[model samples]
Target chain A: MSFLGGVDTSNGVVLDPECSLIGESVRGRILCFPFGIGSTVGSYAMYQLKLNKVAPRAIINRSAEAIVATGAIMSEIPMVDNVDTSLIKSGDRVVVDAANGTVEIRDVTERHVVTSILRNRGRVLILKRSDKVGSYRGSWAGVSGFVEKDEGDEEAARREIVEETRFTNARLSRRVPARGFRHNDSVWTVHPFLFDVSSRDVSIDWEHEAYAWILPGELKDYTTVPGLGAVMNDLLSRTSP
Target chain B: MHLTKDEEHVLAGEEGAARQKAMELLVSLGDIYGAERLIPVKSAQVSGASFKTIGDAGIQWLEDMSEGTRASVPSMVNPLGLDMRRWRSMGVSPDFHGKQARIVAAYRSMGLLPVYSCTPYLAGYRPRRGQHLAWAESSATVFANSYIGARTNREGGPSALASAIIGKSPEYGLHLDENRLPKVEVNLPSVPEGLVPLAGYTAGKVAGNRIPLISGQAFAEDEHKSFGAAMAATGAVSMYVSKGTVGHVRSRGIDRSMIEERVTISSRDLRRCAEELSGDDEWDLVAIGCPHSSTRELAHMARKLKNRRPRRNCDVWFCTSRMVHSRCPQHIATLRRFGKVLCDTCMVVAPIEEMYARTATNSGKAMVYLPTLGRQTASFRTTDQLLEAISR
Candidate 1:
């Protein structure tokens, strides 16, 4: 959002070397990004884009920050936020209904998966996936598996915990709605769960190689799955009391 | 969100195109922040007035928006990149001045007052207690909300302009009484001479987005200007309440039980901040008045320098609003011996990087921007220290 350095208003290209969309032209295209960063004057940069006839046709963001929102309104550009921006691609045609605050991506599919966390006392269990697993092999993750068709999220969570950790006596403490993440072409809608167990002991199966009981603060030290720490924090903190 | 019939008509594009666009901006922002309705504001202070900051694209947008738009309330503009009368002497090229003049013309055509100062409250547009405003300049918004006992969210430039055109803003954030209550208590030991801005800078980092209740020091109105300017520069919150009699809080129905964080800023901490902010002493430019100098500040500097002779070794600028500049002509004449008494511009938004490599300023807000926006190696000094350095 550096109006002075990051954008070339005349050509509608992102000139910022640090920007992910460097050299990309926003002209007549629906621009989708997480949110704007940098100066408040970045709002003016957006207006500049419109003046040059290089402004984005529409804007979609994960969340609406004030700067970009102000810019879009001032420039008369249609915009919507609180959308899963990862489901959008560069060439994907986006229809932004700012009045309803929704964005629809023309061609993309969403897949749902259940990721369950097993907690014993104060520590949560982290399992390393086996190489024989479908995706993210050798990566540390929560007890996870794809949701079977027609299965409830909680029922799927219980099944995954029993199959991955062999903990049949685990009680479901908390369950949160699914969150989406973009991986290659498919959108992973991870339904998170926190289960309390009586013991730290676990029986590993063919899907996992090793397991460890680590404090939640130490989740950053290990290379786990995407959004694992966030999912764990949300589930654990909500059910703490 | 609920909209009245008139508001709905404007949103539905029943009104003229400009007013409809303004209504749409307000309505969408209201939706984003979950504001229940739009409230009328007494005034607005719009930023992004400078050509150096906004550039060619800004000129184009302003020209387009100016076609049919006019301010519904009393609105003032922020500082431009150069003094309108003295651009030739300030080292601003003709090309930049031409672009800047177009911006000024556009704003003037839109019915904005030509008080190109960040301290619009000081320059005749002061709002009363309990009045709501849609001010954009961070320093002015903080001053209006905290010191003047007004209500306003820190608005962006275009939103504030929209508010000016329609005379209404989204009722959210600081406009709500519940959000005005102090969530953190900041205790300060006696702030050293010329370190008040640093204390504010430190307080901002400690408070983050929470409204801080400051205790243990009495500050004058001018000190509040510098302190609050620095606080808003570093922190996300627009208002802070001091414990002293000055700028007292009207905590009518607020619950004080939510305060969980208490921070103490000691003399050692201030010293550390000063040491960390102090850069090289040798500077090509020594500029002051980041929030724009008040009349009293101009007179004080004039009194101090009236007896001393100018060294004239390096460039010096005494930045202030034209209104204040007009009020202190004798002071301006005396200070002009030392350096240029610049108006409608300060070191932060000016194109100082193209002219000077190193700069020194006393303002904590300037210390944050001079390095990044001005692209100069910055040196932090007190006003007295900077004045003494630039004088014989």
Candidate 2:
């Protein structure tokens, strides 16, 4: 944002007609955005907002770039980045720990899940969830299920693969660390595992309607769950030469 | 980020609040960029100095920062919104002049040099080859890294100030030798006269974030200045390596194996760029020197305008550093007949939007900034074209 033209420093209102928050005021609240764009002069504009006592108390970003980071530091406003900003709502009460580089949404709970990719003959299995499943119904996913309260991530991954696919001869090839995604009030921490199965045949449970074996690149054509492509690519690339 | 014991102490606020804040900024930036440690810097050149750019909020912040902190290394500032001594005569309002004075006073208390030109290297703070500096001005940063062979990441104002106060910057980006290698190869077939800046502009668009190794041409010092300034403005890169000619022989360091992409810009391409950038002829102001004019540029302009008479149809400005202006009294006198010989200010940083709507310039950097920062309908012309329009 060209701070000189885009922002009204006196009122804390974004003035740029092209800006999404054109009519919104960034005053006395925790402002969450992807990142700042435009000139370096935006730093001084942020300071001007602080001098007017209309600056945001804190700022949360998906990733912090230089311009906004400099502005936040100079203005002494608390800022934290590398946050999944989609989890945060308009009225969500957020706490920013700038020193630790962490942000917490007060009312949100984190849920851990295990999504295991079963590979047979260089093709990964894609399972389409039935309407009976709790979330992501009628969506394509890997062999996925919630992690039980006492189970380890690997144990959860193995258990889910067996329960969902009914494959007993599956041998684990690789296991990646957990990755997180925001779905409403819960952040789904997905633990992905790659398993090489001796057979392509699978018996589907009531949770899934059908299953298909697809190459990693073909995963893009289907409407799969969020971060499914990333999970498959990570596991496949690591296991490849 | 790995901090030394002293740095950790500063981070822990064992030092004063000002140092603690500066340290915090450096550490946070270091963490963001995955820097392992901080390295000492030789000097710093900071931007965001103009009151027109920073506004009242910047004035307050600087005034507050000046209370306890001081620059540990020699630091020079970018151009201000008005000339320090002759602001009133330059048509700057008293309100802006007052705010600018407060900013100047704040930086003065913090031990920053009052050389408010963008050409800090030309203003007696030239960094030697391989010296690490935390420079904010895009033009100067590119010049320092690519021309002078110094080391620096293109820093923001607050971060550069932080480095100035601490005399250290996070070791990352351009500071590391491994990161300095050129990734793209730009082959230029002889840049024509009055087209070097446009060539640089095109080269910047081709290079993007990667450093481009330019081949097939060797440029003079002033030519390199304009070229690098335009390149930095048009691209995110801080440096470009030109092949051929250094000192008594051809300098080596172009690794062909390292180049990922190769691009060639011809004279026809530069002409197309000029055609695309060319705007209408009617202008309210014709401002020169985006990266302030050097002494040689001043003398060259003076020689061109010595036989011509000013038309006085529109207001014109010849912006240059105070050092260059002082060195060329005769040139300054000759140039002043055509326009105001402004020192310590340029079109980009000054509040030209309040005064003029349509502007013309010979700088590629000004072409990029005039429409946005200056709020002027910009027309790009060659130096001869602009001089002809202003004179006769």
Candidate 3:
């Protein structure tokens, strides 16, 4: 978001055609966006909004650029960035801890789940989640399960691999950065791990009805769980040193 | 980013909120750019001074900042939207001057020098070779980094202000020696007479964001000024390494392997740039001085127009800094006969769209900005050509 020519300072209304919140007012509400663009004078336009008593109560950005950060500081508005702005919906009750650099979205629950890919001779294992599963039933995924509060993420990943696929000899290869996916009121933070196995002999568990060993390129053809394809590519792109 | 105990205290808000805020901005920028630590700066030249650019929002922000803080270092400001003394004569309205006055006052109260020109290097307070600075004016930043061997990234208005209050800037980008090495080589093998700005203009287009090693021709000081100004305007780059003009920087052993891209700007290309940017012959105003005229430029223009008579075909403004204006009284007087010798402002930052729809200038930088920012159908001309067009 930009303030100069991108927003109306007098009424606290967004005028930028490129913005998602066009025609909506930023007054007295928390503003969440990816980042700012346009002139440096946009910084002062933000201050103008503050003087008009119509500035955002707080601001959140996926990444803070100089323009918005300067404006936020000058307006004395609380700001926190380095956030997943896509998870935040308009009208969502959001709390920003600018000092601590944390954001809390009210009514949004978070779930931590681990998913592991078992590779044998370059072919990867993808399981079809059974209807009995609570979420994303019938979606294709890797050996996955919830991460227990007492368990470390990697420990949970190894445990899920053994229990769900019945593979004990799979050696841990690599782990990619965790990603969050929003569904309903829940934010599923998925931890992805890759493991190398000696055999393609894995027994199916109760959580999945079917399993298939397919090329990494074919993962996109199947209806998979959210961000599974992305995590799979990330996991497979690098070899463990 | 590594901060000293006092810097940490400022960031932690142990200092006043204003200083803390300034520190926060500096530290945040430092973190963003991956600076190891903050480095003390010699001075700061801040942009976003013009009321036509900043408007009411800028005024209020400066006022708010002024109440709690003052410049910790020697800081100079960019141009205002109007000349304080001659606004009415320049056809500026009372309402515009009133707002412009507030902006000047806000900056003044914050202990900023009311230099009100982009050419702070020319108006004194020139940064020495190897000295660090935080300057917001793109043209001056280029001049400082390339011509003077001063280290600085092209800072934004608020960032430069933060540096002014903190007396420090985050060491990154052009502030570092490695980043100053030219990635692209721009060879202006042969430039035509009166086409230095266009040479820079074409070179900027070819160079893009990379630093260009400008070679194949030597440039005078004033020639370098207009060249660097146009380059910074058309390109994302703020610094250029002119072959021989880099002074002490030539000793840094610039690796030939670093020049990954080599582009030769032909004399034909510069002529094309001029022809294209020239647009329509009819113009509402003919304005000069984008980086603000140096004393030499004012004297040269005065000499050319001294023997001629005003054509009175259209309005003409020879824009320069008050410092430069004060230095050459006879030149100012002679130029004033042909047109207004506007001080403290240039065509790029002024509210020219309100009174003029079509404009003509000798500045290649103005050709880049006037169409979009000033809302004018901009035309390009050589300084001699413009002088001849305005006077007989």
Model 2: CA > 4 A from native: A1-8, A13-25, A215-223, A238-241, B244-251
Better of 1 and 3 by DockQ: 1
Compared with the true structure, what per-residue lDDT tens digits does model 1 show for residues B1-392? 79988889877877677778788788778988999999999898888899887777678777877888899999999999999999899999999888899999999999999989999887878889889899989999888888888989988877888899889999998998778878998988689889998988888888899988888888888888999999999998898887542233454433456687899999789988998999987889999998899998898889889999998879999999998898889999999999999999999888998899999889988988898889989988989998899887
Rank list by DockQ: 2, 1, 3
RMSD of each: 3.6, 2.8, 2.9
The deviation in Å at residue B370 for candidate 2 is 0.6
Identify the runs in model 1 with alpha carbons over 4 angstroms from their true place: A1-4, A89-95, A115-172, A194-232, A239-241, B245-256
Could you give candidate 2's per-residue lDDT for residues B62-154 as a string of tens digits? 888888889999999999999887787778899888899999999999999989998988888888887999999999999988888888999
In terms of DockQ, the best-performing candidate is 2
Per-candidate TM equals 0.88, 0.93, 0.91
The global C-alpha lDDT for each of the candidates, from Candidate 1 onward, is 0.86, 0.87, 0.88
- After TM-score superposition, the amount by which residue A228's alpha carbon in candidate 3 deviates from its true location, in angstroms, is 2.3
- Kindly report the docking quality category of candidate 3: medium
Per-residue lDDT of model 2, residues A29-136, tens digit only: 898887788877788888888889999899988888878888888888999888877677787778888779888778889899999999988888999999998988
Judge candidate 2 at residue B37 and give its lDDT.
Answer: 97
Query: How would you encode candidate 3's per-residue C-alpha lDDT over A1-241 as one tens digit per residue?
Result: 7889888889999999989899999999999999888778888889889989999999999988888888888888998989999888887889889889999999999999999999999899999999998988999999898999989999998888888888988899888888888888988899999899999998988899999999999987899998898789889886532
| TM-score, structure 2 vs. true | 0.93
Ranked candidates, highest TM-score first = 2, 3, 1
lDDT of 2 at B317: 92
